[model samples]
Target: MFDTIDFQALRRIGLSQALVAQMFNLQTEPADRLMRVTEVQRDRLRLHDGEAEHVAQVWPTLRIALQMQGESLVVGDWVAARRDDSLGDVCWAAARVPPVNHLVRRDSSGLRQVLVSNVDTALLVMGCGQDFNLRRLDRYLALVRLAGVAPVVVLSKADLLMDGGASRAEAVRRHLSGQVDVVALNGQEAASAQALSPWLAEGQTLVLLGSSGAGKSTLTNTLTGLAAQATGGVRGGDEHGRHTTTTRSMHRCASGACIIDTPGLRGLQVDADEAQLDAVFDDISSLAPMCRFRDCHHEDEPGCAVRSRVPAGRLLSYHKLQREAQRHEMTVLDRQRQAAEWKARGRFAKAVSRAKRG
Candidate 1:
């Protein structure tokens, strides 16, 4: 299905030519085949092999090796697998190719969860109406930036409203520091398909994320030129959409790029390092260095550059994001401590068992 793949698209998505060449080599080999993961069950993966697809259990050794490295294979990862000689109807994964990029989010308990792997572009889908939230966009941007993936903000359902009529798309562009591209489009329109074509080139991987009823599935279907994903209408009074897509799935674009469509996220916790947060809020970072005191909180501090530039609204937004980042760090640290304690307890139990046996 992905015959006319665009190498340029792959490059734009951050995949090196060398990596593509390696994937090509795997595809050429008859003994081992490369497959894109579609669904991840408890212990088995549902993978697509271009013409046919199947569910196969990974070799125990491969799983252990990946776990040891503190990494995991998520949906949209390219894996090399072959039929096991000893087991019938099972495939043994010999290797997992390095991901070009990944999109990660922290769960409620502050544990990092891989939303999707090997993503080339993260389509930040947001409704042009009431669902437009710049603060939420900041969270998504932080996550994508930390994952080393490019982000494209997509303002969906634009046709329903007037063009550039003081919408959320304009607000997002104003607040975001970097050259983040924002596209406002009506997913049902043919023009929307054309606008998103550049990112859908062969070997590229794109993942969509937004709140429920943000037109993510609709946009996904539009990009593929087929209604492969189901759609639901927004709520009666609010612009919020019902949860339409429950699972993450990968689809191939006409240009040979792959797209991962994900369910709506109720809350997006920022689990990125200070470097990424600094990159996202560069305006704040640049101002901090000029603060008279090294530990200036920008609150009633003399010669605080951040406070000097701030209007009431901008200052509030800046403090909100800063506090959020601090909270995220604290939560992550707590989770790490809990994990360490559990590991120590396990070691103690093992030692006691050995003594008892002796």
Candidate 2:
């Protein structure tokens, strides 16, 4: 099904050689239709064929298979579906082509939530006022790094910034140690399109991550040259935006790039092993090796190299995120146990629903 796709069509939808190869290896049925997931609903999904959008549901077989693996289809995923024109063009997804990378986080329950997949770059949007928080941005950057994607910190609402967001931009640069790109712009204007053109080029897929009132949806409108996502107004005093965008959706830009806009996140939990956390906090990780104790937690321990050079606040944040990672760490049996528990809960819900109806 993958090889038969036209080269131009694949590029038009942001498909790379690696993803094409992965699809081919899946060896899906020839009758299956290849489409990309644009939105995921309760019992159905909206997909695109590089042209039009169609609503589809996960086939029963595929649903059970995904349940067993503790996974679910999400927006921005390329999937193979069976389309039935006789049923008024209904579609059923039966297979998914694994994404090159996925932006994910752990919910409060410690279960993995895949936000979006097959992404090349992540746009971390933050406002300069009440919506801004350096600690929150740290979690976002860590999530992107864990997903193995490049990140660009976008400071929205530059016009409203007291100093045109210059000081805030510089602060972010210093916080990240100038390792990632930073852009300050008025997201509601056309010039934001030019400021972010490098990441919005053809075939580059980007996801916008930020809190409400940070102008994610507005930026989507500007970049796509259309009202792709609904814009919301902020509260008069606090500047918190209403939850205008309730779900994630994909929008196509004139530049041939795809933009996935997500709803605001109140809190983001970075779930990973200590080694993974170390990668995100490379500054602390690099110095840990020089500590007197190999298992140093960068605390009161003597000769703690990480404690000496790194800022006290950063070291503390590392320990906090590391603790969350450890709480959810698992082996093979742990995964099986979690999957089984989920299935049991699903069955219990079904039973209760049936009883209530009876």
lDDT by candidate, in order shown? 0.74, 0.85
How much is the lDDT of residue 119 in candidate 2? Answer: 93
**Model 2's TM-score against the true structure:** 0.87
Score residue 59 of candidate 2 by CA lDDT.
80
Clashing pairs in 2: none
Model 1 compared with the native: what TM-score?
Answer: 0.78
Off by over 4 Å in 1: 1-30, 50-52, 68-71, 85-90, 164-166, 307-358
Q: Clashing pairs in model 1?
A: 6-202, 213-241
For candidate 1, write residues 117-235 as lDDT tens digits.
87778999988878887767767777787888888999887766866424666676667643698888887776786788878776678889888889988888877788989998877
For each of the candidates, give the backbone clash count. Answer: 2, 0
For all predicted structures, in order, the TM-scores are 0.78, 0.87
lDDT tens per residue, model 2, 1-358: 5336665775777888888788875657777768889899898899988878899989888789878988899998988878777657678887989888898888877788889999999999998778777778888989999999899999998887778889889988777678789999988889998889898888788999998768899899998899878887867887666668889998998678999999987668876888898888998787888999987778899999978787666666788888777657777688798789999999999999999999
| lDDT score at residue 331, model 2, on the 0-100 scale | 70
